[model samples]
Target: MFQASKVAIVGLAFGAFLAPAFAAPAQEAVDRTFERIAAGVSRAGLEPVVDIDHARLAAEAGVEMPPSRVQLFSDAAVNSALLAQDLSTGLDLPFRALTYAGADAVQVSYTSADFLKRRYGLDDTEALAAFDAALAPALDGLDGVEPVPVPTEGLADGYGILTLQSAHDVPETVARLRAIVNAQSDTVWFGEVDFTAEAAALGVDLPPAVLLLFGGPAPGGVAMAKFPSIGVDAFCQKLFVHAAPEGGSVVLFNSIVALAELHYGTSAPPHAMLDERLTATFAKALE
Candidate 1:
């Protein structure tokens, strides 16, 4: 492991220094990755672009020892997620990222930051720290925004998915999400929010929101029989539906990677640096 003494010094040297470089390139990478994956899936066939069916994916991957479907999905991708060989495409960027190799030859899975630090090796990884520094700007600033109501974004019959990487802090991420929901409700049920406990055997805390998905128009009526999160590990990924009567939109507060921090989702920068590979992942998710 490499010591990121330099990043620490940089953080200390510029407590208030602002630079244009402080941006969240991870988000862009995610966007692109998802888009391309979506395309790949489409080219492959007609269905979800990437990663779907939380319970089934886990069961096939062997993560069904405990908890329920909700918990299964939440923990599946967020903190203690499991994935099949097929849906495991890796993400690249300045997200607090932790990943696992899925059964799928081409797919790579993700986890949260706290989970990564407490269980995985991202905390002291020099390359990982550099990744975070590169993606810090896009993840910072959760101190002063007033919680506003979410405006609803109408759902079009032609629906497309926008998966996030999450910021870092959970509470702040939730708060920011609450603000977004309040501002927009027509599109509620903001994606999925997976939570995990420990995956020491495999390494790392469990990917946060790797499967936590949010969608629009009344829970999307998706039957998630095993979805369970409360008190399991203080790990939860419940869907907060935000909508008036006619319209609303669902948008994650930040990259799910950022939200993986749990209570500290927006506190620090990201763990994984935004690279072309990660950027490619983001693009694939949308395809």
Candidate 2:
């Protein structure tokens, strides 16, 4: 496991390097262009799951900024097979796209599926490549769009990542995760996607795999109170269960501390407690 401090440094450095790509889009053109992009994403079959209105939230907090928004979209119907290959991919899902008015030009951006597939060490390159290609239509009519670059190696070296070998198969691992969440208070079950089944229906072969999305209101409320924008990364945690290439099943999730630091630029008291709870939960489930 990567140390929290090390992960923080790496994550910060990467964030800084990518800062330019996230520059706000041009002022006059951003609104219209944003709508077009949003329409395109919908047309591509990616359903909008979360919409974070940074500008409005900042205004409510007495801070001012150009029009900006972040949206997460997902097409579980199509991408389940790809997601099943690597559960860590859930961290990037539903696919996030940001649009903002820059000093010079309005900008729209999203990380490419190819970058994510490689970053997360997911299998089936051909499938991901094709999926990436399929996303072009969404951006076809957009201007000043940027696709964030992800390094080929050390992709997740900056995040607190935990991977465990599961004694049970994929279905059982998912059931265990569900049971664990069900037993907890204030935790919201965000539903599960069985990518293996979704893929099989599409006439593709994907190893047994499932994704569990769950989290509680308390930690999320705390994080959002400190930084509303961080709500994009807060309140939700995911567990991915899939067959390991080496054999057997594996489960994975990002650490709360890492996520807090990455999103808020600082770790909070709640993070430590959340981390402990998550560690214990995973321990019990995997054991």
Candidate 3:
């Protein structure tokens, strides 16, 4: 696990010192790289799964904000193979790229498959290696982009994670999560994706895994307002329900506070409360 507080803070401080030297060229490269990445992914036969233009959205809403965007793209076949290796990898799919105008330069970045393999403790080499290879075309020529370093063992420690033993099966747990979100006045059901079904269609064996995304305007808007970059982590919290190796179902979610800290280098009161509410909602759904 990456040390969220220390490493991230220190890295920023160090980066600040070098910001002046890299300013102009970095920003120009970032703009060019974003266009290159979009074209590259399409050329690679991957479709854009999600595209959030943070700058445009803020502008339309009459808010002045720094430029930023988050785009996710992936090929169905490639993703199926990755899911077969470890269902948890679904959280990082369908391949996200984050671009933002930094103090010195516009920056473009994404989590690497190698980094994720280590973070998730995935051991399916053939699948992961293939997944990594598939990403090359999209990332190939980015001048300054690099994946964040990942720890070698266990799950990524920086995330706030909650694992619950479910009394129901995977499908039922998913249904319960959806119903719970629907029942909440402050939350709205965003969507759900089934990695298990996708992998099974490819003749790749995988335990049932479903990702449930949900959150509403108020909490989401607040977090994004506090730190626009928080859109990468807090826009919609995801609850994953999957078959445990031991024969039961398990439910898990990334902690909003931890994600905020990881991405923004600080914590917010609203995010903490939102995390508690989401944790409670999942606990109740499982019960």
Whose lDDT is greatest here? 3
Model 3, which residues run further than 4 Å from truth? 1-36, 53-67, 140-159, 184-188, 246-248
Instruction: Name the best candidate (by TM-score).
Output: 3
Model 1 gets an lDDT of 0.26
TM-score preference between candidates 1 and 2, better one:
2
lDDT of 1 by residue, 20-129 (tens): 22222322332333334334334533222112222222233333311111111112222223221112211211122111111221122222332323322233354334
Q: How does candidate 2 score on lDDT?
A: 0.57
**Which stretches of candidate 2 lie above 4 Å from their native place?**
1-40, 47-72, 76-111, 114-118, 121-158, 245-248
* RMSD for each of the candidates: 22.7, 10.0, 9.1
Models sorted by lDDT, best on top: 3, 2, 1
**Once superposed on the true structure, which residue ranges of model 1 sit more than 4 Å away at CA?**
1-170, 198-204, 207-212, 218-287
Q: Pull out the clashing pairs in model 3.
A: 1-157
Greater lDDT among 2 and 3 belongs to 3
- Candidate 2: residue 220 lDDT (0-100): 49
Model 3 lDDT, residue 280, Cα: 84
Kindly provide the TM-score of model 3 when superposed on the true structure, using C-alpha atoms: 0.71
